[model samples]
Target: MIKSGISQIGGKYRLKNILIDNTPYHEYFLSLFCGSCVYELNKKKANHYECFNDKNPEIANYFIVIKKFFKEFEERRKKGPYTIISRYLYDLLNAGILTPDDMIEQAIQFHYKIKLSFASQLKFRGLIPETTSKKQFITQAKKDFKEAAKNRNRTEGHFKNSLGKTTRPISNNDCGILTPLNPKLEKRLKYVIIEALDFRDLYNRFYRSYYIKKGLTKEVFIYADEPYPGTEKYYGNLFKPEDHQDLIEICLNSPFNIMLSTGGECGIYLDALGDAGWFIKEVYTRYSTNANNQNLTKEYICMNYDIGKVHKMVMDNQPNIMNYVEG
Candidate 1:
């Protein structure tokens, strides 16, 4: 469980909440980047635009306006698709039905659509826009997609080199190398680790370290070729909503306390954990540099036991613990 006040709206710990809510979807489009940043920065309660000004005012303003502009564009586009909107706005400007500023806004909206469509096409195959009138845009989109696909394939080939000849999906029983726990936790946790590795290599490393610390053996690992839903398949399988739901159910039903690592991956898991009524306590990571360090490295644990009491204790006795974990 997380400590008391850890989830408060201000301070270093606040970004965790932002990451949990925005990362999977917000990272794809540039316009929504500021909203994601604002949420992570704990400025969601205040004016979304103001959050950006607290650090980089100019960039923040740009993002804020972009977000607003996109919202309006979306509303207007509901009457038609981007091509129709572009034509109508252009005609409106030519006929004096729209002002100069309106024309510019419409153009910006069109530009945003072009950029977004091009990026999406490049990221995923079979995404070519059907109504883009500009041949240049289509050409560019195709080129970009091919290049991106090439790069992604290259990266995947490299990662695949690291895994041995275990081509089939790993079964729960084959994951005995993971930390031993209640049978329920063991089955579910192993699957989580395996599924996470399908998205992030670093997550696999973290899980490996976690199991080692718990005195579990290592097992053969595998990655699913297809992307998980709600995320681009390019980076491997995206973390799905159902994945989170499963995790929360497992954690809530568990007999022992749950521990989570800190980072984007863990943040995703915490969303479900929060929904399931688990709170976080202290966050710890094994250190390798300190002389007293147990030489254990690549492990993080967020203890969920007595989260409220532990949080209060840390707040009173060690207010700096937040800084420690935040850093």
Candidate 2:
């Protein structure tokens, strides 16, 4: 299992298996709106061409730099802000103080922001703390700031000193920028095509041009994990209701295989996809907003092809959605 390394709101880190089991056979895979790329990172890459995309500039830049310049990213992470001061750096990056030319530096700041932000959210109001109260959190934040200013590397020692005989081991999730790099994750991402494009544009770019136009629609699979209906605010309120209709229309009319995952809280998905002859399955998943917040919910997986039939067809080595197109 490969880790995404950064935490993101509405990420599918915990729902990897459920999503995988529902996906049909494909030679090409596209993860549109690939937040944290939890599915792409964990999926079997052998004999598959995978593309990871996100419209969010910061999130996409993280993948762009990490995929091509992972060595430099790890080198800079060692000296980057690992404490509460990361919030200041995040602000600077958003303010355009870090020139656009320095993408790797910007990627480092975005990484810290997501990891350190409240509940691992990009637009967070406060810092994440193991303790519940505001007073304790503020006190710790101040100490962390001082440590970061005094010596960047000393932040690790500061955390150790603060722990002071506590049995709880230091974790990267708790330490933000101090999170170690996973070589396996880097290797997995090496061949993945990274794109920062709107969902519609992305679909036309690869899904239509490369596969549909080439008469290879059945060989490609697109998975969309768009921000759920009520939770659009967390994603900067970009995916509007009209966009949902547009996506549904695309999937309904397309010859290629497409699957969508949602939290099952929205009525539009059930009403639209269900009425359009798509297969909708309810899968159990547990979502954790933070260490203390966990909720078990049903995820609705909507797909054009039936997974059971697809699997049987794949097993028989016959011409089907996995390989052959219907005349």
Candidate 3:
């Protein structure tokens, strides 16, 4: 899967081993909290229409920008532009330059800063605006320097060198700039449909309309990776208890099939879903102890439809790694 350029919660790592097998009635697929997982799955499908979405605008825009300018970015990379661009941006920011009017330049700045920051958490979430403080800017710019050292592909965060060597920081060594420098296969996103809108709007209008209009033998499957309640949320988009209930209700009431991945829904969350015929299966993964290290954790996969009717949709809870490559 394309990394989607962010350190997402669970979608990326759960792709190969995820137990949800809810099939669509037709060739159309709906990735509710799309993130990076859907891209990998889409690459596998021969012919299918997909609606990939994330409720978070930043995440959505992340997908949208890559889809739009990846080709143009590729052309620039071929002409050896990033070495200059990456270093120039880095130097400008390190010197406490704050220019936001230039859109492309700003985008590129975000591209580099994000990769370098911890866990890809560079949204400036829960943080205040930038004052003209060299000290503050330098504090942030240091993260960019660190990212340059870990030159993982922009479409990926898994870093390892061919010679098992230390990744020395180069002048133009930003991960995002270096990423599109590659042939752009994993991140060849279809920009036409990727959007940054609220999921409720997408579901109520776009998806619902499509589901009604396109009545076929195949089903429409939605895989949502919503923020679990009571966790320190990413990007400042906190999920309330009622929000989870509403999401479950919406999925339960929809004419299509959906799979939701979340943490500890408790009786209030699951009982409502269970009463509406939803099934709960526990899926395990790792969360950090200090929020940076992986501590073994468990999340749930709730489906709105019954799998007993479908003879093949059966896989019990089995643990797997984040980077499991199926042989």
Candidate 4:
């Protein structure tokens, strides 16, 4: 798999190690809010169709350009696509001689701007912006983060204050890691479906169009990793208690096999999924170390499935998920 080096939300732990092992590869599998985590799923050879979707068009376009950029670069280059070149075409785009109307440079710029964000959670959890060196930015960003984790009482939102000046300008380097593609991975990319659409629209379209049209005989599974329920102040303004209810209702009605993951702190998701005939399983993960230097912050992974069968799958496959966290 062409692994992305971005340290994403779920990428903080060994969830992917277990997720890839236990996750069912249906006739079609889709990651509804995939950021860079798509690489983890693609690590294994696809037995069926694979898709990743996000509501952000910039994100969607970023993937499209990534494929294109890699392909073009691979033609002339000996090894493969690793770096995004800033050439005359890039200069033309910057000079406004050309527009971002479906161009590769525009996509790179979109990715660059997002990287200026201080942390993976962006303006939501990160209290600061990357206006300075990464080390400095993280130092300031963790002020409120440490506070929230320390007390467990106060809600920490976006941190907007920083005293340091930017050491250097944001560039292609800011985005980092233009993941090199292997031939097998590149071939799979041809089949991988990436879309920009509302999750509900994606759900409706899959059932109404692809599900009905494809003659394949296999089950469909949806792993909806929504914003951890109570972390709304951190993960952004999407999955509140009401939204959690809506997500559960949507999953319950769908014909596809579903597994939803959230923090045990999300009482609403746990209660609703547990009550709705979905098996509840919790995986302990260390989130961070305490002010006293002991690793006390435990993040829970609550999953809804049939424990009778999947319990073994979880233990055998994802053993180390409980052992470590990115500190």
lDDT of 3: 0.54
* TM-scores for every candidate against the unseen true structure: 0.21, 0.77, 0.63, 0.60
| Model 4 C-alpha lDDT per residue in residues 37-129, reported as the tens digit of each score | 543344454446667786666567766655556565333332323234444433454457766544455554544334333344432211233
Candidate models: Cα lDDT each: 0.31, 0.73, 0.54, 0.53
Count steric clashes of candidate 2: 0
Model 1 has an lDDT value of 0.31
Which segments of candidate 4 are over 4 A away from where they belong?
5-7, 10-13, 38-40, 43-46, 72-102, 114-116, 121-185, 210-218, 233-241, 286-304, 307-327
Q: Candidate 1 vs candidate 4: which has greater lDDT? A: 4
Model 1 Cα lDDT, one tens digit per residue, 1-327 = 121111111112333442232222111011111211323322112111111211222233323334434345334444443333333444454455754245325533333332332222211111233433434555775675555444443454553322234333222221111212122212211211111122234333434453445433212111111212233332222334455444444345433333333333355555655666554443333322211233332212233344344322111232566687999
Clashes of 4: 1
Error of 4 at 321 (Å): 24
Q: Distance from true position, residue 269, model 3, in Å?
A: 3.2
TM-score of 3: 0.63
Using TM-score as the yardstick, the better of models 1 and 4 is 4
Q: lDDT score, residue 321, model 3?
A: 37
**In what order do the candidates fall by lDDT, top score first?**
2, 3, 4, 1
Model 2 residue 120 CA deviation in Å: 4.0
Total backbone collisions, model 1 = 11
